[model samples]
Each structure stands twice: as C-alpha cells, then as structure tokens.
Target: MPAEGARAGAATRGTQPAEGGPERPTRRFPRITRDTARPEGGGRAASGAAPAPARQWPLLVVLGTVALGLLLTSLDQFRPGTLLIGVALLAGAGLRWLLPGVGMLAVRSRFTDISTYGVLGLAIVLLAMMAQPNPWLQIPFLKDLLHVTLSNK
Candidate 1:
C-alpha cells in the first residue's frame, strides 16, 4: 500500500511512471493562483483614505468628459461633441504619460496606453474636422479612393 502511494505521488509530481506502459505526459497547465500582481503604475491615484472616486480621479474625469461629449451629440451638436470627445482621449493619453500612478487608468503598460489614446484621439479629431456640411478640412484623394472602391461603373 505504501509503495503504491509513493509511486502515485511520484507520477503526479514528476515524469516517473507508476506502472509504466510508456511514460505518461505531465500536466500541460500549472495550477491556477488566486490573484495576479497589480499592473505597474496602477497604484492608488490619491494616497490615504480619499475614497474610491478621488483615488481614480483621472479615469473619472476622462469618462465624465466623454459622457458630456455624448450628451452634446444627442442634443444635435455633432461637430463640437466629437471634437470634445477626441480632446478627452488626448487628455487621457497625456495623463497616462505624465503621472506615475493612475489607479485603474493604467490598464496596460504606459506606452500602450499612450499610443492607444493618441491614435484614437487623433483619428476622431480628424474625422470631426472632415464631417459633412461645410467640412473644415478636406482630402481630395479620399473622394477618389472611395469612388474607385465603391463605384459600380
């Protein structure tokens, strides 16, 4: 009985077989752990007991500005609303770059966060500038490209 238990334990732990036909493969995955380490720079934004909102103020501010932008759009203020939303994303990128600890705002590595924010913000702002009904900016090639792509004739 003791020998049987020893053999089973050895097989479970290592590649040693209990009653080997051919050495069985070991577990492919390791045991799961309870918690993961917090992402770097994801520390509490405001130290001490300042409540959750205050701690993640950067995230809240960005989100609030976005919400306001959305409200403006719903109220038939399209161009300004989109412009505001884009500006908010740009601000989020700046905050992520400048601040060391930004609580939940630091969802990914610093570079990734900044790159995502900057690209999306720039795209939105550009699109807003190019929106219809007397666009502020124009790209003549885009019209040609779309016509080439979409035109049946």
Candidate 2:
C-alpha cells in the first residue's frame, strides 16, 4: 500500500502539468453572434449577404384585427366580437397563403399554417354561433356531437 501523502494519480509517462497553470478555456454551445451582412440590392441576394427577411405587415394586420375584436368583446359586443375574431383568423390564413413573406406569421410549413388557421377559425365561428341564446346556425349533428354520456347504464 502507498503512503497517505503519495496518492496514486494518473499514470503519466512524462507529459503532465506540474501543479499550477492556467486552465484551458472550454467551448460551449448557443454562441451569440452579430449579423453584420448588409443587403446589396433591394431584392433577394444571390449569395454573399443574408437573404431578404420576410415582411411583417400580414402578421400586424392579424394582430390588429384580434386586438379590435378583444376590445369590442370587452365592451359587451359578443356577436360582432366573435365574428371579427373569426374573420381575423381567416384573414391571417389568407395572408399567409397569398403573401409568403409574412415573417413571424410563417411559423410552420405552408400546408400546416393554412390548415391550422382554417381549423381554428372554423371552431371559433362554430362556438360563437352556439353561444347565442337562440343559435341561428343550428345543426342537429353538432348538438348530438356535444352530448356525451359517460355513465355506464
């Protein structure tokens, strides 16, 4: 057995640090870097500079519509608010489809974006219709669909 002070370290043949030296800096992921490339022409660049970023007008429009809808709803205007929200969603979908350059709006792929927007808009509209005291857009199938029985009778 070795002495207490004589600890058995790594079996260094020859190349090993004596005792005190500056520790080597280790590299880590998610490095923040600046984007300094400037666009040459007004259009999309071919190579060097980064591609032209997508426009944001479409998303802004959608957001503005939603804001207006929310304000109206807060003012006890249920019908118009619900309709406006549905319109906003639908319009957002149309914008995403027609104007491919909707920066933040283009979250998912083209097919996914359109489908998600369309489905969500339809659901909101349907829910709004059912929310009325005397729902004008009454569908027997939908009423039946909502009636779920969990009891084992």
Tens-digit lDDT string for candidate 2 (1-153)? 564223223112222332454333334332555774422222221233543342455667788898999999999988778878988998878876776356667767777888899889888877887786887588887666567554345
Residues 24-99, model 1: lDDT tens digits: 6776554776687776779988986898799999999899999999999999999999999999999999999999
Deviation of model 1 at 10, angstroms: 8.4
* Best lDDT among the predictions, by candidate number: 1
Least accurate stretch of 10 residues (summed lDDT) in model 1?
21-30
Clashes (backbone N, CA, C under 3 Å), per candidate, total: 0, 0
The estimated TM-scores of all candidates read 0.79, 0.59
Q: What is the lDDT of candidate 2?
A: 0.66
Question: Which 10-residue window in model 2 sums to the lowest lDDT?
Answer: 38-47
Candidate 2 regions exceeding 4 Å error are 1-55, 145-153
lDDT of each: 0.89, 0.66
